[model samples]
Structure formats: C-alpha cells, structure tokens
Target chain A: MIETDQLTRCYGHLTAVDALSIRVEPGQVLGLLGPNGAGKSTAMRMIAGFLIPTSGTARVCGYDVAREPLKAKRALGYLPEGAPSYGEMTVREFLQFIVRMRGLKADAAYRRFDEVVQRLQLEDVLGLCIDTLSKGLRRRVGLAQAILHDPPVLMLDEPTDGLDPNQKHAVRQLIDTMARERTILISTHLLEEVHALCNRVVIIARGKLLADATPAELEQRSRYHGAVSFSAPGSGMSQEMLGRLPQVASIEVDPLDGRITVFPKVGERILEPVERLLREQGLEVSEIQLERGRLDEVFRQITTQETDGARDAVAGVNA
Target chain B: MSPIAAVMRRELRSYFVTPVAYVFLVIFLVLAGTLTFYAGDFYEREQADLQPFFVMHPWLYLILVPAITMRMWAEEAKGGTLELLLTLPLTLWQAMLGKFLAAWLFIGLALGLTFPIWITVDYLGAPDNGVIAAGYLGSWLMAGTFIAIGACLSALTRSQVVAFILTALVCVLLILAGQPQVLDFFQGALPRKLVHAIAHLSMLQHFDAISRGVLDVRDLLYFLISMIGWLIAGVLLLDLKRTR
Candidate 1:
C-alpha cells in the first residue's frame, strides 16, 4: 500500500533519513523497528506526506506523495508522534472535526465516530476535554481521530508510547484487528510490540533497515547463538574439559548447581554432540536441551547499532 | 472547494469553540467604545461620523490580527499534525485560502459588532451612512492586510511570540511607509520614482483613501493582492515543510 524509492531526507547537513526504501503490503502490520535517531519516524513521516524527502519520493495507494499528495493522503491515516491535538476540543468534537474534514456524510460520520469511540473505549471521555485527560487517554483519542475515516493505510509513530500496560495491550489488539483490512507501518523501538502484532519487522539503525522478517524467522536467521545445557557428574567430567571438546564452542559453569552450559556455532548439532561428548567422558547427563536465540535477544544483537556498515547494507537493500 | 470550506468551518469554529471569540469581541467593543466616546474625543468634536472609531483599526489590527493567526500553521507544526493536514487531499492553495478566508470572516465578524457605533452615530445626528459604510469597508480591508502579514509571519515560526513581534514590526513599516517623517527619511536615500512606488504600497495611502469615502478599485485590489501575496507565502512555507 505504501512504497518509497531511495527516499532520503536531510535536515541541512544531517541526513535524517538516508536513501531507504521500504514497501508495506495490505493486511499486514509492518513494524519499523529502530533506535532513537534511527530515521524510522522520518521515513514514516515522508510516507505520510508530512515531510518531503530531500531526494527520491514515496507513494501511497499508487499516488506519488510529492506530485499528488492529496490523492495519496486520501488513502492514508497518520498518527504522528507527540500526539499533539486541539486540546480545548472534546474527544467527540475532535473526531467529528476530522470526520467532517474527510467529507464523510454527517450520519456516517457520527456512526464511524461512535464505532471508533466504542472500539477504543473513548465514549466515557467523548465529552471530556482532551487537555484534561491523562496521556494514555489522550493517545486513545488521537488514535481514534486517525482511524475515524477508515483509510486504507496507517502510518503510526510510536502509537503505544505513553499507554499503560492494559491500554497498550488493548491498543495492540485494536491495531492487530485493524491490520486485517488496512496496511499499517508502525515505527517503534519496542521489539515485543512488533513481535506481538507486526507481520513484518523492519530493523533500522542510523537511518537504515538491518533486518526485515517475521518474528520467528528473525530469531531463526540469527541462529548462531544457540546453546545447550545439562547437569553432569563433577566427579568425572569438568566444565573446563567440556569447553575443550570439539563442537562445544564454550562452557559456562552454573554457580548455583554447577551444571555445564555450552554454546556451539554453525554446522554443529548442539544436543547430540553435547550428549555424546558427556557420555564418552564418563559424565552422567541428567538433562539436555538446546536454546535458540529469543526474539528480543536477536533484536538486540542485530540492531546492536555500532557502525554504519549494516545501515549501508540495509539502505542498499531498500534502494 | 468543499474540503476547503470544511477546513474553514473548523478553523473558524475553533475561534468560537472556546472563549476566544467572546473575549475578542468584548475587548474589541470596550476598546472601540472607549475610543469613540472618551479617548477619540468624538462627542466633544461633535462629528456625526465613525471616523474616530475606525481611525484606530490599523493600529488595533497590528496586535489583534496576529492574535488570531499566530497559532494557525505554527501550532499545527508544533503539534505534529501538520503532516496529517498536509497529507490530506487538499491542494496547498486550498489550505492557505481556507485558513486565510476563515480568519478574514472572523475579522469581519468582529468588524460587524461595531454596528452599534454606526447605530450610535445615527442616534446622535444625521451621519452620512454612506461614508460610514465606506469607512467600514476600508477598516475590514486593512484588517485583511494585517491578517495577511500575520498569516505569513505565523508560518515562519512555531512560537507565537516571534509571530506576534514580526507581524507587528512588518505592519508598523507598512503603516509608516507614507508618513511625513518616513517620506523625509526615504527622500534622501532614493530617487522620486522609487519613492512614489513605495508610497503607493503604503497602507496609509490606500486605506486613508477608502476611509475618506472612496471605495476605489485600486484600494480594493491593494488589499486583495496583499492578502493573496501573504497567503501564497504561507502556502509556500507550509508546502516546503510538508511531511510527517
């Protein structure tokens, strides 16, 4: 539903968003994962037609953002960061205003307004002033305004930023449910958020996307960090000896129970190799299991974000 | 155009949606009434016209117009919703004209409330209602000029303070352009042709003509061109910064 072609935005000398192109499909939640200053928000802004790219261009629903912004914007609903809204207005007033701007019929507008307020549980606050509400409540109202028109594409920047845990859960659920009919591109630093709701992850660091894949697939792709752990008799096999064994890359002694933990790199079957090595060495293995990298672990590793190499690689891929 | 009107409705509604309109009207009425009866020396001078009341408009608008427009696009930018508005299927001109016309209509409403003064003038004596009407047109047109400057300045910064000061400064220059002291200052600096061209651009020259019961097309075009010029500048600034 949205596509960028070598999109680069420079704020004077600072390249806020490098030549990074990404495509989000309909009925999918694409999480734009990146650290602070990673240009994820900038990318989302450009696609939303709020910020023009310094070079290249973006399109929404087949309309070029620079050349035909109105056409593209017709298919877009943008939830900008900071959630700045007309605070003096009531929740209902704000949504109705947006509905009117979208040119929705009065009856249809109110119905859509009611639907959003009900779905986001904003009915109680509909009559309340936006400035009086807490941050979480305010965010709910902001999100409500965004989806009032039911646009085909949504570009949400830090959608769940200030919400409480329950609100976050509800918001994520609403986003996930809404993703069934709309294309969504979310820019957030939270990996759990992406894992829980996003169908595709775009990991960007320093204005580049490092990894873009499914939750499980990203974990599997970074499978080099898998490890096996088991308890063995200390009388025969020492943890030091296990580390020296072939295919057992390294061994760590569990301080509490003295169990041996082993990590093996690629081309090594961790479980079988550890089990055989322990038995041959006269050690009675009590328990054995292999643990691949968790999603969070892979996220931290892949988006470790040190040098510009990976950012360049991702930018190259996007281009 | 419907979208533009829709935006205008909301923008105009925003002024009245809060206490802004009521407060603005009260302030305008109290100031206008005070200028008419006491400070303007209207009763003592025994003039059966609204000359004293409208004489303060160009100065009043230097402060009031910015109050209305300082938050126009700057607030949207600061709030991060400029992206949402820009991405909407409205052209740059639509948004600009929508916002400008909304403010213009609002200034018109505030100008409308001065009808009591017109009524008061008729009550006391047989005032020339035609000249009074011309005066009203002239004041509203000048308000448009101030609003255009305000609209342009508002787009340059997110802070209302900057917008206010810059708009007031620019409006002051426009007002002072044809003043005797200003003319003397410029006469030594440039040739007569340039001075005449600059004098024609002076708000005092055109607005004073209409205030004296002359609704010349030249004066009307001055206000419209100035309005469109600043509106265009506002549109360009907004279009440049259009993004999420």
Candidate 2:
C-alpha cells in the first residue's frame, strides 16, 4: 500500500506540490494525470524518499518515508522520471548492481534477475551498454532495474514517454500482468493510457488535486457522455427534428465530414430514438458509436477549469 | 553484499570502463617518476630514501585527486542518477563512503605501481625499506584526505568542471597554509597562537611529519578526522540539495 498525506514541496516562493493527499491500495493501478509542470515528478520523488517534503508525510507499507527511509525505500520500487540509469554500464551489469544494492542473496538474486530480464524481454540486450540502446530499449532496462527487487509497491514516472506503439503495448501488458498483486502508481499525460491500465484515476493541476475518481466516473463528467454520433453522406438531417424528441438535448453536425452527433437529456437514453429517427427518414448511416464518455474531453475540462479558476483568483486579488 | 560494498564495486568498475581511470593512472605515474628524478634531483642528492618521491605527493594530488573525484557526484547529479542512487535502501553516508573508498583505492593502486623507484633506490644504495613503507602509508592517508575534499566539493555542484576547480582551489589553500611564505605573511598581522593553529590545520604539515618516518598518532588522527569530517559534510550537502 502507498499513502501520502498533505505532501508539499516548495522551491523558493514557488510551491511545486501542495497539500496533496492520495492512497493506493493493494492490487490497484492508480493513474496520476496532469499536464506539463503539474508537480507529478516532484510528488513521486518525495514519495520515493529522494526528496524531503516541505511538510506532511509519505508512507510505503506503513513506514513513514522521513522517519524510516530505509524500510520505506526497501518496500517500494521507483522508476524515476526519464528512466535514468548509468549509461556506461551494460544492461546486465546495471541490473546486477541494482540487485546487489537491494541486498538480495546469491540464489534468490539470480532467480529474480533471470525472471525480470526474461519478463522485460531484456535478455537479448543484456550485454549492450545502456548508452548504445535505443530509447525504447533503454526504457526497458530502466523498468527491469526498478522491478528487479519485486517490491510490493511500484512508482513509475512517465514510463511510456518515449516508447513506440509496439513497445508501449508490451509495457502496458506487462504492467497489466503485474497489477494483480502490486499497487502501481503511474503518471502520464496520455489519456488512453489511463483508460488502458488504470482502475482508479487522480487528476492534478497547479500542484493541487483537482478530481479523484474512476475512469468511468471521470468520463461521466464530460459533455460527450451518453451521446450518440454517426456519419451519413448527403443525408438531410434537421436539428429541429432531433430537438423535438423528449430525450434529445441538442445536436451537433461536423462541418467537414457531415457527421451528426445527438446528445441526450440529463440521465436519459437517446440511442434508440436516434436510430428510429434515422430509419424513419430512410437515412443510411455509415458508422455509429455510443461513447461511454470521452476521457480526453473530461481531462481537458477538469484541468482547464482549475487553471481558469486560479487565473480568476489572481484577477480577483488584482482588482 | 552490503549496500556500501555494492556501491563501491560498481563505482570502481565504472572507473575502469571510462578513460578517466586510465588517464589518471598514466598521468599520476608519469608525473611522480618525472618529479622524483628530475625535479627532486634524486640522482644528484644520492639519497638512500624516497623523500624526493613522497615530498611531491601533496602538489601532485592537488590537481589529480579532483580529476578522479570531480565526477563522483557531479556526474550522478547531471545524469539524473542521483535520484536513482539515493532512492535505494541505503543512507547517504554509505554512498559517499563507497565513492570515496573507490577513488582512494584507485589512487593507492597508482601509488603502488611506482614501486620501481623503490627497486631503483634499493639497487643503487642500501635504502631504509621500513621508512619507505611508512612514506607509502602516509602518502595513501594524505590522498584519502584529498579524495574526501574533492568528493565533498563534487557534491556541491552538477558540473564536473566546477567541482574540479573548487576542489583544486581548496586543496591549494590547505597545502599552502603551513608554508613559510604564507606564515610569514600572516605572522605580523595575526597573533602567534592563531598562526600556530592555522599551521596545524595544514594537510602538508601533518603529511610531512608522517612521511619522515615518524608515525605520530596525532598525524594519523589528523588525516582520519579530516577525512571523516569532509565526508560528513558531503552527506549533509547531498541532503540539503534534495530539499532544494
């Protein structure tokens, strides 16, 4: 388990992280979502015991990070931002150094070493120096070192920041397999990654927690939730006709592609009514989708509101 | 293995992988040989001891020890591995000590490789082998002091060049503290007791005493205490930087 209470860090007058409290229970993959410079990496560093917070506390497996750093650090594995490692050492040597630093014994270290190497598909490049590897392979080596000890909690900062699509899929799959037994916290700006891997999501902006909810709950806050969209070529569809339905709230047409999207009234279903209307009009729709919710839209809405809110507060003070 | 040992092994191995170790070793050996023979006038002095060799260590180490230790923490900070190493289940002291020991050992290996001088003296005259061994021990101890100073300064910045320059500047001040020129300049301005205390703080004074075949407990303690003091300062600096 990982828990932090009111963890804050400040540089001079600028507060990088502010009163951020979060909890990640066992077997839960928590996605920390934020835009650039949102203090995601700073928060992770404090939790990992690399930086001391200006106030409050972080704990891993019941050990307070500041009070019992060794115990807390031993119980957690952190892949720092940019996945930094010794570039001069070979992948095998660097991993071996990590295993040794973890104080694993001879036989157990060997077993864990082989298991992590094989799991990360790092056996082929074990002898290659980290500096010579491509960005994707270097990230794999960083991941291998972080998981070499098999700690119960893992924190990865931008784990897939520079990987190709195939490598991203492979890494996501690995995290999926490991998610069953470990409490993993991954920070990313990629909304698709939150949907693909996270069971719980926390959004932060300007170093403060903006919203904490599951992926579906966050999507529900979006305007696109429960909306039906379809494309029809050269078909006559009137906004007034769709507005006549009791379940319909509004309609939007794509100026470029002529794709029409019908939004539902609050807590109402409009897919059936929209289908009936399309059939009655003898309109042939090419493709259709009922969006559970658009996460990107929700993410933008939540984060931008926080920024605007801060801007207004500054304006209020100025006035 | 313990965390300190693990860190030390990795650090020592990394030195070999880069050209820093080879370059430092070659330069140190060549300088020591040249200074002992030509600069110290060993052939003309007809000395039966390695005084010519031992006397040049403080000056030689002022430039070279920083070269070995400048990258100790500066590279880690620049490369972002400082976060990786600090987050491991080890205290800052362990990492600092491990890096110091590795650099000190590398210097010791370079010092050891100069045994051909000892053989040359032995072949030429009946030299005092016991005194030569004491000189070697004293030289190694003094190198430890320089390594500690360099490592501490390395932790103060992310640029190796800055670390190297700062360490060299500090080492020069410490080595010159006991020189007659500095002391004479200070004698008229400062009180006698303060000048005496400043001389005592000079690494050159203590090292000179030990290298002259006198194994004073005070001289050994001076090196040990200074090494520990500088290492503690380094650990504190690392902690201070973390919060910054």
Candidate 3:
C-alpha cells in the first residue's frame, strides 16, 4: 500500500505540489491524471525517495520515505519519466546489474530474471545494447528493471506516453495483469488509459487535486452520462420537440453530422420515449447508442473550470 | 553483493563496453612513455630509478584523470540516468564511492601495465624496488585525489566538457601552488606562515616527497584527506540538487 499525508513540494515561491494527501490500498491501481507540469512526476519522485519533500511525508508499504528511505525504496519499484537506462549496456548486462543491486540471491535472481525476460518477450533483444532498441523496446526494458525485485508498490510516470496504439494496448495488458496483486500508481494524461487499467483515478491540474473517484463515477459527472445520441441522415427532428418531453432536460445537435443527443433529467430514463418519438416520425436513423459518458469532456470541464475560477478570483481582486 | 560493489562493477564494465577504457589506456601509456624518455631524458640521466617516469605522473594525470572522471556523473545527469540510479535501493554515498573506486582501480590497471618499464629498468641497472613501489602507491593516491575532485565537479553540471575544463583548471592551480615563482610572487604580499601553509597544500609537494622514497605519514594523510574531502563535497552537492 502507498499513503501520503499532506505531502507538499515548493519550487522557490511556486508550490509545485500543494499539500497532497492520498492513499492507495492493496490491489488498487491508481491513475494519477494531470496536465503537463501538474506535479505528478514530482509527487512520485518524493514517494520513490528520489526527491526530498518540502513538508509532510510519504509511506510505501508501511515505511516512511523520508525517515526510512532505503527500507521504503526497497519495498517500491519506480520507473522515472522517459525510462532512462544506460544506453551502452546490453539488456542482459543492465538487468544483471539491477539484480545485483537489488540484492536478490543468485538462484532466485536467475529464476525471476528468466521469468521476466519471457514475460516481456525480451529474449530476442537480450544481447542488444539498449541504445539500439526502439522506443517501445526501451520502455519494456525500463519496466523489466522496475519489476526485477518484485517490490510490493510500483510507481511509473507516463509509461505509455509515446507509444503506438498496439504498444499502448500491450503495456496496458501488462499493467492489468500486474494490478491483481500489487498497489500501483501510474501517471498519464491519457483518459482512455484510466478506463482501461485504473480502478481509481485522481485528477489534478496546476498542482492541485480537483477530483478523485472511480472511472465510472468520474464519467457520471459528465452531462452526457445516460444521454442517448443518434445520427439520422435526413430526418427533421426538431430540438424543441425533444426538449418538450417530461424526461428530457435538453437537446444538442451535431452540426457537422446532424447527430442529435437528448439529455435526460436527473434520475429519469428517456430512452424509451425518445426511441418511440423517433419511430413515430419514421426517421431514417443510421446509428444510435447511449453514452456511458465522455471522459475527455469531463476532463476538460473539470480542468478548465479550475483555471476559470482562478481567473475570476484574480479579476475580482484586481477590480 | 554489496550495493557499492554492484555499482562499481557496472561502472567498470561500462568503461570497457565503450571505447573509453581502451582509448584512455593507450593514450596514457603512450604519453607516459614519451614524456619519460624524451622530456626527462631517461637515457642521459642513467638513473635506474623510475624518477623520470614518476615525475611526469602529476602532469599526465592532470590531463587524463579528468578525462576518466568527467563523465562519471555528468553523463548520468545528462542522460537522465541519475534519477534511475538514485531511486534504486542504494544510498548516494554508495553510488559515489562505487564510481570513485572503479575509476581508481582502472587507473591502477593502467599504472600496472607500465611494468614493462620496470622490467627494462631492472635489466639496465640495480634500482631499489622498494622506492619504486612507494612511487607507484603515491602516484595512484594522487590519481585518486584528482578523480575525486573531477567527480565532484562533474556532479555540479550535466555537461562533460564543462566538468573536464573545470577539473583541469582546479588541478592546474593545485599543481602550481608549490612552484618557486608562484611562492615568490606571494612572498611579500602574504605572511610567511600563510605562504608556508599554501605551499603545503600543493599536490606536487607531497607527491614529490613520497616518490623520493620518504613515505611520510603526513604525505599519505594529505592524499587521503583530500580524497575524502572531495567525495564528501560531492555527496552534499547531490543532496542539494535533490532539495532544489
């Protein structure tokens, strides 16, 4: 388990991370969602015992990071941003070095080494220098080193930031498999990654936590949740007609494709009534489905609102 | 394995993996041989003692030791591997000590490879092997001091060129501190006691003493203290960077 209490870091006068307090229980995969420069990396560095926190402290597996750094670090696996490794070393040499540094006994080290190599499909590149590997392969090597000791807590910063779709899927699959038995914290700006891997999401912007909830709960905050959207090629479905329904709260039309969306009032189900109206109108609907909610929309709304609120406060102060 | 030993093994292996080890060895051997025979006039001196060879080590190390230590921390910082290494389950001092020991042993290897010169000297005349051994120990200790200084400065920046230049500049000053002309220039302006203290700080003074077969405890202590001082400074600088 990972826990932080009022953890804060300041750069001169600017508070990069502001009194952040969070806890991740065992078997939870927490996704730290934030914009660029949102202090996700800074927070992880503190927890990993790489950077000293300005105030408060972090604990990994019941070890306080600041007071018991080696103990805390021993219980954690951290992959710094950009997955830096000694480029001159072959994959085998680098892994061997890590195994030694981690103090794994020879027999168990060899066993774990072989298992990780096979799991990551790294047998083909074991002898190749890390400098010669592609970005995706480098990322895999970085992951391999982190898990070499099989620590209880793992922290990865933007693990899939620069990968292709297929590579992203593969990495997510690896994380999903590992999530069952470990407490993992990964930071990314990619919203889909949250749904795909994270059991809990913490969203922050400008170094401040704005929301912390499960993926489903976050999606529910979006206005599109429970709303039905349909694309009709030539039907004249007026917005006023849909808005007049007792269950409907508002209607939106996509000008580009003429797809209409009808939002239901709170705790109301309008799918049946909306479908009935579409059938009665004999509309040639090409496609229709209910949105679980758009994560991108929620992300944007939550982040922008904070900035806008700050701007308004500044304006009020100036006025 | 101990963490320090593990780090040292990896660092030493990396030196061999790249052309750094071979290139440095060749350059060091060629330069040491050329300077001893040509500049020191080993043949004309008719001295079986490796006095000529030992005298050139300070100048040789001034140029070469920095070459080895310049990338010690600079490359790690530049390539972003410093973060990866530090986050591992090891202390900062362990990593620093590991890197320093690796570089020291590597230089020791280069010094050891000069045994052909020893064989040549022995074949030529009856030279005191005990004095030669002392010279070798002093030279290796001096190289350790140079490496510690260079490694400390390397931690101050991410640029290898900057680290090399700064280390060379500082080493040159330390080498010149005991020169007669330099001391004379400061003789009138500074007090006699202060001048004497400054001269004592010169690496050449202690190195010359040891190379001459006088293995004074003070001379050995000087080299040990200088290496320790520089390494401690390096650890502090790394910790400062983390807080900053």
Candidate 4:
C-alpha cells in the first residue's frame, strides 16, 4: 500500500535520500535496514507526508503525498525516531489527543484508545505524565499513539529502540499481529528484528538500495548457509581432519565454546556425512544443528561493501 | 471535532498543564497593575477614565505576548512533535490557527482576570463604561497582533529564547515607528505622506484610536489584517522548512 517512485531528498550538496523507489504491499512486513545516515528515516518521513520530496512522488494507498497529503496521511501512521512526545501530557491524554487528531469520532476514539492501551500494556502508566515515565514506557506510549487509529499503512522507525528484551519481544508480537491485515515498513539497525518480524527485507546504504529480498533469501547469500555446528567435550577432531571429511569445504573450532562449525561445499549436504564420521570416531557430540547462515554476516557484507566501494571511488579521484 | 478545534484543545490543555500559563498570567497582571498605578500615575491623574490602563497595553503586550507565544512552534520543532503534528490529516492553516487561537484565548483569560480594576473604577466614580469596554476590545486586538507576530517569529527558530527576543525586538520597532519621540526624528527629514504611512502602520497607533472609543472600522481591519498576515507568514515559513 506504500510506494515511492524515484524519491529524492537533498540538503544543500548532500543527498540524504537519493533517487529511490520501493513498494510495500498489503499484509507484508518490510524491514528497512541501513547504517547511520542511510536515509532510512528521511525516506520514512517523506512517505509519511512530513518532509516534502525534492523530486518524484510518494504515494500511500494510491494518494500522492505532495498533492493529496491529507488523504495520504489518513492512510498512514508514523512512529518517528526517538519516539518524541509531549512530556507534560499524561499517557492517556496523549493518546486521546492523537485519536482526535486522527479525526476519529468520540466513541471511536475512546474505543481505539482502550484497544491500543491494552495492546501496548500501558495500563500501569495511564495517568502518568509522559516525561516522568521510563524510556521503555515512553516508547510504548509513542507506539500506542501511532497505531491508535489503526491506519492501513504503518511506518515505524526503530519501534523498539529503548525497550528491554521483554518489551521488545512484546512490540514485535504486536507488529506481527498487526501485519496480518496491514502494510508495515519498519527501519531498524537490529538485524535480528528483520528476521523476527519482517517477511521482506530492504537493505540500503549510501542512500541507495543495495539488496531487497526475504530474510531467508538474504541469509542464503552467506557462505555459512547449510553449515553444521556441533559442540563436543574436548573432542580430538582437529580443523584439518574435519576439513578432510566428504563435502566439508572448511571447518572452524571455537576455542572458547569448543564448538566445531563445518561449512559445506556449494550444493552439498555435510550433516549426514559429518554425523557418520563422528560416530565412526566414537566422539560424543553434545549439540548439533544446521544453520541457514547468519543475517548479521550478510548485513555486514552488504553495508561495508557499499562503504568500501565509495572509498575506492574517492581514492580513484585522488589518483 | 474540526481539526482546528482539536489542535486548539490540545494546545490549550498543554498550556495549563505546564507552568507557562500561570507564570504568564501572574507576570502580566503584576506588570499591568504596576504600570497602571506607578508609571501611568492613575491616582495622580484622578481622571474617571481608564486611559492610564489602556495606554500601557501596547507596551505590556510587546514584552509579555512573546512570552506567551515563544514556544508555540519552537518547542514542537525541538521535541520533534512537529513531525507528528504536520503528518496528521490537518492542513497547515488548521494547525497554525489552532495554536494561535489557543495563545490568544490564554491572553484573553489573563486580560479578563483584571476585572477588579474595572470594578474599582466603577466604585470610585461615574466612569464611561462604553470607553472602558472599547479599551478592552482594543487591548484584546492589540494583544492578538503581538501574539501573531510572536508566532511568526517563533516558527523561524527552534530556540524559545531566540523567538522571545526577536519577537520583542520586532514589536518594539513596530511600536516605536509611531512614537512621538521616534517620529520627530524623521518628521523634518522625510516626506509627509511617507511619514504618515509609516506612522499608520504602527499597531500602537491603531490601538490608541480604538481605545479612545473611536471604533473605527479601519483600525479594526488593521489589527485583523496584521494578525492574519503574520499568521500566514508563520505558516509559509513552516511550509518552507517542510520542503527543506
């Protein structure tokens, strides 16, 4: 329900968000991943109808953000970075204000207020002023305000930034539940959040889209995909010996954890053969599992490559 | 509710919840009382009119109105709530007018609380209630003019202190443009029509004409037009920042 066509934003000589286009369909959760200054938030701001795009168009539910802002804004709910809120207002008051600003009727506003409060578990701090609440509580309040209206399109920037582990999980669950019928585009630096909450991931760096795919698809890009990792009690299997096993391309032994991770050659299955080898050697395996590769590894690979390429271009100019 | 009313309610609620409204009311009332009795010499003049009280309004508003409006948009920008506010389905005019009306009503409340002074004048002598009524109306319009200027200035910066200082300086210059002391310097050097135009632009001059029970449509239009002009300018600035 969200689409941007060659959307660009420039501040003086710096292009904060370059010519970019992205589409988020209904019932799909998109994880927008990028490092600092990747223009993720800027792109979100433009789509939310807050910042005007320097060129091109951002449309929500078929309404142009620049032309029919009110209609486009009506379809979207945005949680900006830092979850900034009016500190003087109580949590309840703030949510109520948001409900009204969203143009809900009194009965509908109150009903939605109760629903979001219950969903976010904000009952405890309902009457407390926002400034006096803890960071996590404040973030929840901010979240409650954004989703109170239950807009069709939700753009959340770091929705779980300051929350504790439990709170983060709860918010992820909330987003998951909401994702059943709406379009959600969340930008976060936490790679695990993409795996946990997003079905589709869009990776951007230096104001350009580098990769966009499913979490599983991105994970498959890692060399560690289909690797087998097992921990044994002081097993005498050296890295070289483990590497000699059929289909085992490489092996690594963690000195601290005593885990042996064996990477298979492309298009090979090493788990069955490795298990057979361990059985033949009479070594006790404490734990063993197959991994789909680490998302963090792929994230690092994509973002760093962009930076390195930029550096090489700079060097080429200098030469 | 309409978007304007919705925003107005929120802004008004925030005003009272913080210390800004109370502090502004106390300071404004204290200064009004002080200026009326000490500086304007109300008791020494022994006049049955509220001329002394009416005369000090433009000056009082020049300083205090900025205090009331300095944080209107500055705090929104600083705290990042401007994003939340602007991204809503409301138009820019709705939000700007909502905030401006909230501040104007707050100043009106502060002005309304000075009823005891009117009562005192009534108890002491047979004063012209019509003139006093006109003074209140004129004072309210002048206060709104200052508030609109302050709102425009507040939108230009993210610093409340800067908003207050710049608004006060602008108000001072506008008032001084018509002051006898300042106008005398230009009287002999400038053309007559140009001097008259400059003096006519002063908000203080329009307020004086109205407070004297003249009730001129031109003076009322001036205040209304200036208020709308400044608020429009504030909205334009916000629009500029949005694109940037």
Model 2 deviation from native, Cα RMSD in Å: 1.0
What stretches of model 2 exceed 4 Å from their correct place? none
Enumerate the chain B TM-scores of all models.
0.95, 0.98, 0.99, 0.97
TM-score of chain A for each candidate?
0.83, 0.98, 0.96, 0.97
Candidate 1 docks at the CAPRI level of medium
Instruction: Estimate, for each residue in A218-272, the C-alpha lDDT of model 2 and write its tens digit.
Output: 9999889999999887666455677899999988889988788889999998899
Candidate 1: regions farther than 4 A off: A223-226, A229-247, A253-261, A265-290, A305-319
Candidate 4: which stretches are off by over 4 Å? A233-238, B187-190
Give the best candidate by DockQ.
2
| Residue range B116-167, candidate 4, lDDT tens digits | 8999889988899999999999999989989999999999999999999999
User: Quick one: ranking by DockQ, best first?
Assistant: 2, 3, 4, 1
Please provide, for model 4 over A86-113, each residue's C-alpha lDDT reduced to its tens digit, 9 standing for 90 to 100. Answer: 9999998888788878879888777778
Q: Kindly indicate the candidate among 3 and 4 with the higher lDDT.
A: 3
Per-residue C-alpha lDDT of model 3 across residues B1-244, encoded as one tens digit per residue: 9999999999999999999999999999999999999998999999889999999999999999999999999999999899999999899999999999999999999999999989999999999999999999999999999999998999999999999999999999999999999999999999999999989999999999999999999999999999999999999999999999
Please, what are the lDDT tens digits per residue for candidate 3 over residues A1-319?
A: 9999999999999888898999999799999998888899999999998889999889999999988988998999888999999999999999999999999999999999999988788999999999999998999899999999988898999898778898889888888888888999999999989999999999988778999999999999999999999987765645667788899998888988778889999988888998888887787777789889999999999989988998999899999
Q: Which residue pairs overlap in candidate 1's backbone?
A: A50-B242, A50-B243, A50-B244, A51-B243, A51-B244, A70-B89
- Local accuracy of candidate 1 as per-residue lDDT tens digits, B93-172: 87777888899999899899878888888999999888889999998989888888888888888888888889889999
Query: CA lDDT of each candidate?
Result: 0.81, 0.93, 0.93, 0.91
Say which prediction, candidate 2 or candidate 4, comes out ahead on lDDT. Answer: 2
Maximum-TM-score candidate: 2
